[model samples]
Target: MDMDVRRAAELARIELTADEAERFGGQLGKILEYIDKLNSLDVSGVDAMAHANAVYDVTRPDESRPGFGLEKALRNAPRKTADQFIVTKVVE
Candidate 1:
């Protein structure tokens, strides 16, 4: 490492001591090297994919269904009106 760890830390809004910066700079250099190696690989025929493995969503079609009415919804309320649950007015 010759990477500018201090500048990177500043950009990331992180504080790093001299020792920590040196250590992290070396690690980041290694990571960049690995990325460069990966980039050098030939894959002209491969399709671009979002993930390494095949992924799919198992889903069902959305359908409308009947639901409980206001009376049933307010059945357990301590106080309620004909079509709503009643609560104390807190805002003035």
Candidate 2:
């Protein structure tokens, strides 16, 4: 698990000093060792997600709903003309 700190720093767009690299190397070594330990777990007879317990709520039926009046709604607009909102040109 020899992680090239230089390449890691280059990919992350950061500079790592020698002291930092040494510290990171030790930390990464421990992490990889722990991962190797996890890989040795005996789960051949285990049922995956046997502890998971959750259920979705029943969805209600969809129905058509009445809407507000267009003319009354447009009456409150700051800028509206010809049944359309008067806005600035979006394209040049």
Give TM per candidate: 0.42, 0.38
Which tens-of-lDDT digit does each residue in 1-92 have in candidate 2?
Answer: 56677787889988889998889888987887778876778889887773467656787679767766788878889999888889889999
Candidate 2: which pairs clash?
none
lDDT per residue, candidate 1, 1-92, as tens digits? 26788998999999998899989988999988777876788999998989988899888778877788776777889977766778889999
- What residue runs in model 1 are displaced by over 4 Å at the alpha carbon? 42-92
Predictions in order: lDDT: 0.84, 0.81
Give the CA lDDT, 0 to 100, for residue 1 in model 2.
58
Q: How many backbone clashes does candidate 2 have?
A: 0
The candidate that wins on TM-score is 1
